[model samples]
Target: MSRERKREGALYLCNQRQRGEEGKASGKEDEREGETRTD
Candidate 1:
């Protein structure tokens, strides 16, 4: 039971990290678009 719980925790952490990276990527894309628009 403990091992299963640990696995779930690890999976959750990985998912959160991936989500954070995706958010950062989208934010960078938005910045690029804004810069191009201003130019």
Candidate 2:
């Protein structure tokens, strides 16, 4: 369940970044892993 755990972690980070207006980095990180956290 490593991937699932990573996804959850990424989502948490992404939300934090979105709040700080730095979501671009988070989105790129997710995209590189074939996932996305679009707003």
Candidate 3:
């Protein structure tokens, strides 16, 4: 509702999104490793 609160909320959302992206990247790396093992 307040401007400061809005800024904090945005920061929190951005941090959460960054974490999700990192998780996805790590998962992809693991899949690549599995493929390499198969090859």
Model 1 C-alpha lDDT versus the unseen true structure: 0.90
For TM-score, candidate 1 versus 2, the one ahead is 1
Which structure is stronger by lDDT: 1 or 3?
1
Return the TM-score for candidate 1, rounded to 2 decimals.
Answer: 0.65
Candidate number with greatest TM-score: 1
Model 2: CA > 4 A from native: 22-39
Q: After superposition, how far is residue 33 of candidate 3 from its true place, in Å?
A: 20
Consecutive 10-residue window with the lowest summed lDDT within model 3: 23-32
Regions more than 4 Å wrong, model 1: 28-39
Please give the CA lDDT of all the candidate structures.
Answer: 0.90, 0.73, 0.89
How much RMSD separates candidate 3 from the native structure? 7.4
Give the alpha carbon lDDT tens digit for every residue of 1-39 in model 3.
Answer: 699999999999999999878878777876788899999
What is the model-wide C-alpha lDDT for candidate 3? 0.89
